[model samples]
Target chain A: MTRALYQFLLWLHPPFFRQRFGEEMLWIYDESAATHGVLALFTDGLASLARQWVMRAGTWKLAVAGAGGLLEILMAGFFVMGPAPTAHVAATQSIEDPAQFSGTWKGSLRSRPIELVLAKEGTVWRGEIHFQSPDGALRSAPLEDIRVAGDSVHLRVQVDDSDMTFSGKLVPGTLGSRLVGALQATADASDDLISYSTLQAFHA
Target chain B: MREDLSPLVPLSPAILHILTALAGEERHGYGIMQEVARQSEGQYKLGPGTLYDNLQKLLEHAVVEECSRRSAADNPRRSAGDDPRRRYYRLTAFGRRVLLAEVARLEGVVRHARLRLQTNNPRRAS
Candidate 1:
């Protein structure tokens, strides 16, 4: 029956759907599978296959029908069965060594003061801009999209629409100095705001 | 209940984790990643690429909404002048309803299975 077919599709589709929605979907699936047994899973897989075939047929209604039919099956099962059981995943990295970029440096943008926080973690350098805006209020923006090569630093920041690159050299025991180059934005009259600067060095 | 079920297609594990993490409170991308890791006891880790991709999809579906920047009263960690570094997310009413319904549906399935298993096994009854 239509209900049986719907239960089957729920089983066939990989748990990718649950990942996008919520774990509740997986919980529901687990419950449904437990009640219906392997038959429900098999039915879902077969229905998915049939829909894939119909999609390849190149007709409009059949394609729509295949999609609509599959959807009906999921809804019917959802209302009757509830949520499916779900599994979880974790993140690979953690933020450590927060002090690497703790020092202060001074720079300028068109003669405006740009104070930076240069934190060094081993060799990788993280920089932050700590400066007062034109209104004399302190603000900060992360030096995102960083690329450090040897003693030279190459990075760009967006001010409005133009991307301005900062090319600088590392001065040992001194504030690194760099020149700003302007690049055209997709649109006119927009310029990227230049923020922080730092040399990329390997921490020994 | 039968208007259109296509949008409610079961989500992937990664997407589900993001949604589940946001079920109780709002969190940005990084916060969701951290919480999911903790909830799973570090078993299922989602990389940046996977996390963001799933987030984009969820945003499109309107299941999760971006929260406003935390006010000073809301975030104790806010430094005096530090720019806000985090984005927050929360579940929509529709999303909550769907999640609850799904939970009930699954529970029903589990109850039926338990009954069948017990009834089919005389040893279990004894």
Candidate 2:
């Protein structure tokens, strides 16, 4: 089952890591697998494997005992196993309930283009906001203190030491088809919450 | 001596979050992940690999250190309910200084950028 595959992934990690965090990783899998979804869990496992290998790059520890035999068996196993099961609960669930805020909302704040990506996991809502600089590069930040009331939404993004709070509401029809509001940054409190609308065209 | 943190200024976001989380209190791997997510209001998430590898480097650099149960016992705030088997880490004094320096450096950059912005667009001045 998924448990065996996860265990196999864990086994591929360097021994030093397996010795340190093997049980804790398994414990987390047991506790949050249902919440984080199967796909995210496997992705996390793969990330851990890559990290351990990369960090041990220069050490003699790279020559792990039994790794040669293990790799041969794994390649054979990969040929035998079919496509991996995927649970996209994070994507699908974000469309339901509280995650109605989920999507890519693109617009301009004070004439600067910004993009916000929102998703919900378990009860926690997490996402990032990317602001395109004048040079065409983008500097992004994570959204914080997300509060929703009726159709109104409020979120904050920290830019260095300053905080910009976006106070807006979803244009009603169904879900967050459109969002209109003003983003007032704390750095310029004297400024108004200049009117604007951000289209959620990136994600349906 | 300037105690040059120029070499460490502009830390990667991952390292910054990890250091900030440990600054609040010592924590295990899961605790650190949860703390970063909670601190940033669920916006920033650290995967197991990202957490440990950066943590390993921080440990190697001595900015972060493993805090065994006996070491954690000295910390009055550590809860009794914490699992004894889980390893905990905390930011060292040097790490705190580095974080503060980074913050200060960022503030200066923001300030300088703001001044330039106002100078470029006189009407936007506030």
Error of 1 at B24 (Å): 1.6
* Tens-digit lDDT track of model 1 for A93-148: 11122343246655543224666556666756676655555567666766545555
Q: Can you list the residue pairs that collide in candidate 2?
A: none
Error of 1 at A160 (Å): 18
Model 2, A10-74: lDDT tens digits are: 88887545654676677667666786678888887898787677544322223332344456556
Could you give candidate 1's per-residue lDDT for residues B1-126 as a string of tens digits?
A: 443434564556777788788897776555676678888988875543355445545553456655433332265544566333344567767667656656666688899999999889766454
Best by TM-score: 2
Flag regions of model 1 displaced more than 4 Å. Answer: A1-204, B1-6, B70-85, B122-126
Candidate 2 CAPRI level:
incorrect
RMSD to true structure for each model, in Å: 23.9, 26.2
Highest DockQ scorer: 2
lDDT of 2 by residue, B81-126 (tens): 7664566788778789989998888899999999998889757466
Q: lDDT per model, in order?
A: 0.49, 0.67
> What would the C-alpha RMSD of candidate 2 be, to one decimal place?
26.2
